[model samples]
Target: MKKLIKYGNENSQYGELYLHDTNCIGTVCLFHGGFWTMPHDLHQFDNVAHELLNLGFCVWNIEYRRIGETNHKWRDVFDDATKAINELNNIKNIYNHVNINNVFVVGHSAGGHLAIWLNSQDLKIDVKKFIGLSPILDLEIAYYKNAGDGSVEKLLHGNPNEFPERYLFGSPIKLKRKNSSELIIHGNMDDYVPIKWSKLYHEKIRKFTDISHLIELEACGHMDFIDSKSNVFDVLKSNIR
Candidate 1:
């Protein structure tokens, strides 16, 4: 069963923890992607949470403030993610059956970008592995390409040339860490956030550490990564370990 929990003051910034009756392996921190805007929220990850629970994982599906919301900033989204992770780590006292050391992260689309960026941050809890499903790893490229109808600019508050430091701080490509074990999965036919981003990210990270890998799924699209019935589901199931 899944239990609703609040990680932050706002109702939008909360998490759903999927707990098993027994034999829980670890936790999977889920972040949903909708170009970092308000149109999409954590509800999209309900199926993902259930699936992860069935796979013996305690899923912490999180929701955060988006750009469309009142007075919400791009940095707040990142801060919300950090707070969620820290809150989950503290939950061991309440839910002692779950393993904390095996905590992993699975983020799709824009959520994937957040997952990668969050992994780069110096958090109290160390993520065991980060799985990004079609992440927008390069903010600079996303800004130039104008992905999601200028979603990059909307999130960063300006274009790359206008806010180079913001782009530098938010881009996962620029924030790649040497100690992280990152697996990026992209669909070959993804029109949004194209597979090339993951390819370039893997290429860049592999130079510093051999722990990063990029997998391209045949006949998959942008949403296939989150579809429980898709073949990519098998890939996600296997990689959660």
Candidate 2:
């Protein structure tokens, strides 16, 4: 069982913190998936939270409002993640035995996209490392595919033409930050997000910053990166240290 604590708006689709302490050295904050989404299903959070706990990492898995999650935007979700991490950092004593410096942020699918988006932001409080497991980092690609009839476009509030700059910001492949927050992980070979997003993001950012690294995985698909029993766990574990 996980201890639940509510922060931010209890009634609003925003500002609720699902705090889980694994009593470990690293403190990881995980966001859920569904196209940079929220009001998300909590099922995927369990295994990774539990695995990180058993591995001795204090995990503060977060829950925030997503696209269909109340009145939120991609930028707002990014801010929400930032504030949540700062909130946790402020009250680290409550988390217990958690290393403050080893703090990390991770996401799967859309959540993975959010993790990278937030990490790539020009914020004052920097996340130590980011693990975007098969994140939809390139909104433009999804928009072009019109897959799910432009489901990715709809999440960004419709039509990349309506929000050209927003697409640029959300896209790790497009934006070139002089320095990036640490990113390391692999995308599932079968996943639709494609390795190109992570790949291009690495290629461009690596020119200016050495903090980012992306690994492409074989025989793995999308959510498999977070599953402890999956082969990705070995790859993720290998580099996390």
Candidate 3:
């Protein structure tokens, strides 16, 4: 069964929870990507959430305030992501069968950035794994590359020189290496976020931890990671365990 659970009072501060029947292997938290804009939402991951539920993992597909929304802030997007993950504790209280301890966070595109960023936070519960599916690892690079057509500048309210601290806080590349196992899967053909950022991030993270891994898919694109019929989805299923 699926339930809409609120993590905060705001309209966007809620997630769709997909529960397992009896026993669950763990919890898989999903964040969808839309360049922090209002055009895309959690509905993009609905198919994948159901697929994960069929695999015996409880799923939390989160929604947070994005640009173009009324009174939206960039920092609050990060805050909402944190609160949504932390809400898993309260979820555990109601659904004891859901394993919060063995949680895996999966994100695509900008959502990948949020997932890895959430891993960097000092949260109440530890994340077992952080998976980025063609995520934006470096905001500075994304800004220069003009990824999302100036979305980075719009998100931080300035360039890297102007708001260095905001970039430091938002970019996974600028954050400390997370203790949790990290996996990044990017397609060589991805024109959206590009595979370069993922490769760069993997090299940076490898200096600190041996558990981090990056996979470059041959003919895949940015949207393949979210597609249920794509091979990237199969790769995602294999690694979540």
Arrange candidates, best lDDT first: 3, 1, 2
Q: Candidates' TM-scores? A: 0.96, 0.83, 0.97
**Predicted model with the maximum TM-score:** 3
RMSD of 1: 1.1
How well does candidate 3 match the true structure in TM-score terms?
Answer: 0.97
Give a tens-digit lDDT track for model 3, residues 85-112: 9999998898888888789999999999
Cα lDDT tens digits, model 2, 38-61, are 435545777877777776676767
Show where candidate 2 strays beyond 4 Å.
10-23, 122-126, 147-149, 176-181
Question: lDDT score, residue 215, model 3?
Answer: 87
Instruction: Give the TM-score comparing model 2 with the true structure, all chains together.
Output: 0.83
For every candidate, C-alpha RMSD to the true structure in Å: 1.1, 3.0, 1.0
- The number of clashing residue pairs in model 2 is 2
List the candidate 1 regions with Cα displacement exceeding 4 Å.
Answer: none
- Point out where model 3 deviates above 4 Å: none
Ranking by TM-score: 3, 1, 2
